[model samples]
Target: MNATLVAVVLSLFSAVAYAAAAVAQERLASRTSDSGVVRLLGSGAWWWSVTLNGSAALLHVAALKYGPLTLVQPLGALTLVAAVPLGARVAGRRVSAVEWRGTALTLAGLAALLVTASGPAPDDVLSVPEALAVAGITAAVIGALSRPGTRPGLRHATASGLASGVASALTQTVTVAATDRSGPLLSAQVIGVALLVAAFAAGGLLLAQTAYRGGLGAPLAVVTLANPVAAAIIGLALLGEGLRGGAAGLLLALAGATVAARGVVTLSRPVPEPAQLPTKEPEEHPIAAELSEEEHPVAAVLALNPQSASYEPVLIPRQPAPAHLTPL
Candidate 1:
């Protein structure tokens, strides 16, 4: 098959893996009172999530073989497209029209971006010092925010997402840089990139787990957005790929992306309302102290009170029973 066909097939598989992984995360989120992240990561769902994510990564590398890394990496963002609808379907959620609008905007932006990504390859290679600096900076940020004292899952997720993006950028750089060159990436650069990818991915997953504390939407959104932006930057800086039509196209794509991000922000925008336990205020008392007026008459009391709520009075009612058994 042609490379474009290959890329398309790979992207589809990537989407499927992401969709399944998201479903697993959502399941874990529903089961927990706090964020499902930590517990779910330790549960069966976590393993499922890992499996799906691994599939996406595998497909991603496969797609890279056919398309430019710049072309292929950005498409990884499609995982969200598959994930959102699948998430809602699996959760039995009916998203509001506004959420749909937001999703549409995001899709438009992504489409615009892919179309405008035409360009010749630029340089491939990061000096060891630069890679080290990036990795250190990203790692430090993740370590600081992920400390025990930080805010709950959403915040941790947001912080972790940024780190994950850096990891992806470093990883793709390594992947692309070593694609055709090098005797073996058992060399220092490959090893360094692998370490970088591991650190970021591990941290990101932990953060994503944290983010799901409330629901799956927010943290996942952060990761989705951050990963693409980071990859795009690396695609440009390290790979020499650029917007097809220069400044104007880049500007339009930027505008579209901004709109898309706004849509996601809107979709996952935190609601201010505190979650309320089922309110008991309006419900009738389970066992009312005072009987209703209808129960005032002896006859009514006897009739309305089901056997479940009746007391024997210790004075056997003057009623007859069948011969087989008698009340004690």
Candidate 2:
């Protein structure tokens, strides 16, 4: 098969894996009250989710190896579209109609933005100073956004999604750098990039997992929108890429983004009372209650000894029985 075909296949598979992982992680978060990573790590389901995500990352790398960033990265957004139905089925929960509409809008907007964007350009190896600056700035932003006081809803999820997007962009950069270079594997530049990649990737995973603590729709939308956008920015700024249709393309991209954002906001709005399933009432068991009453010997004993004090057997004389025995 041609490289493009391979890349397309890998990207599709990667998106599926990512979607499954997202569902698994969301289910884990919803069920677990403990927010600590250590506790989460102990769960089998969490580990399974991690495995799925790791597989997705590997497949994504393979796709990038064979395809352009512009094509492969945007396709990753399909994870959000795929996750909604997968989560609803696996978790046995119904996604609200509003959420479905929002998801559709987000997906459509993301596709427009990616399609209008320019093709990938040749990128030079980033200097040590440039790498350090980017890493420091990104770390600072993520740290600030992840502070304890931040509420655990759209705000937290948006911050996490942005961080994840940055991490993804960095991963692509590092992958390119590693592939293009023909030096010793343990070189200083390569090592530094590897460390940066690890740090960013770890941070992204933590943030994404935290985002799942909130509902799936808004946070997923943010991540879906932000990831390719961040990558596109990196491609334009550092990699020297330009838009296809210039001004018109920019306008179209902006409009698409606005539509997507509106959709997300609509989805994140409070669900109507009618959408929520009512709490089931406990069933009455008249037969069981009657059977229980009949089976207990304590009640019969209490009835037979109403006059007996301290629940002890009384020693009554048998004078009439003795007279009957003398006649026999």
Candidate 3:
């Protein structure tokens, strides 16, 4: 098949794999309350996420091999459109109607973006130090942003999204470095390329986990959307990929950004109070649980925190609250 066709298929498949991995990660994040840094590396789900992302990265390289940079780079964006609904479905997280509208807008913007650009750009390569510098800076930001203890906020979300994007960009960069046409695949320096890829991927994963910890959707959208977008910008700047068209392209760019941004903004809105529910996990200590069982067994699941310090009450003979609580 032609390179564009290959790229199209690869992009779609990448979208699927990425979407599924994200669903798994979001679910894992929700279930645990550990530091995002620890969970970033410790979770088995993260490994799966990295693997899926690697596959996507490999496919992306193959696409660039035969296709135009314009075609291949924009197609990478399909992953953003793919991640959310898949996440919600897997996690039983429902999307609001506003979110649905936002998703549609993002997809529309991407579709427009892909169609507007034309022709492939020539291959380019970054020196070892250049790649390392880029990846290193990205890693620091991602690591800082994904701290689990941090409250979810615009800063964290934006940073996490940027880190995620950097991860995506570095993956593309590695793809380029690994498969540059004039050089041998492992010409005594491929190790550097491989290491960079791993480093960037790990950082991205950490950032994403943290992003989820702070907030969902918005951070998710930014990272997924921005990563490849940044890479494409780099490609245009460093590798000489043309912006394709003049005033029209500029207008399209603004409009598209607005649409995608709205979609992200809409998707990020928290669910309304009408759908709120209470949890008793914090209140489920041993005595409370024991008394709860005798009283309301139905509320146990609702009130129990899996890691709560309290234990289910056990009947012991006569233990009194020392003299302090007696009749003083």
**Best candidate, TM-score:** 1
lDDT of 1 by residue, 1-328 (tens): 5665577678678867866776686677567756545555568767878888787777766665566545655565566666677876875766656667777877787677666764433336565787887778766767787787676665676676677667656665566667656457467877887787787777776677666666767776776777677667766776565776678888877876787687667667543443688855664332332545433223212233466676432211234457778667
Better of 1 and 2 by TM-score: 1
Error of 2 at 79 (Å): 1.9
Worst 10 residues of 2 by lDDT: 294-303
lDDT of 2 by residue, 1-328 (tens): 7665676688789989988987887888888756688998789988998899889988987776666565566677678767767866875668779768877886787667656653543345456676677778777877787888776655556566566555555666566667775656556776786688777766666677778788676676677666666666665676555666789988887887687667656655545545566799985344334444334223222224565544643222223335657665
State the displacement of the C-alpha of residue 3, model 3, in Å, after optimal TM-score superposition: 2.5
The residue-level lDDT of candidate 2 at 91 comes to 54
Q: Show the colliding residue pairs in model 1.
A: 35-213, 37-209, 122-240
lDDT of 3: 0.61
Give the higher-lDDT candidate: 1 or 2.
2
Error of 2 at 217 (Å): 1.9
Clashes of 3: 12
RMSD of 3: 13.1
Backbone clashes (count) for model 1? 3
lDDT of 3 by residue, 197-303 (tens): 66655555655665566556666666655666666665666556654567787677567656766766666666554545776566545644455433533333333
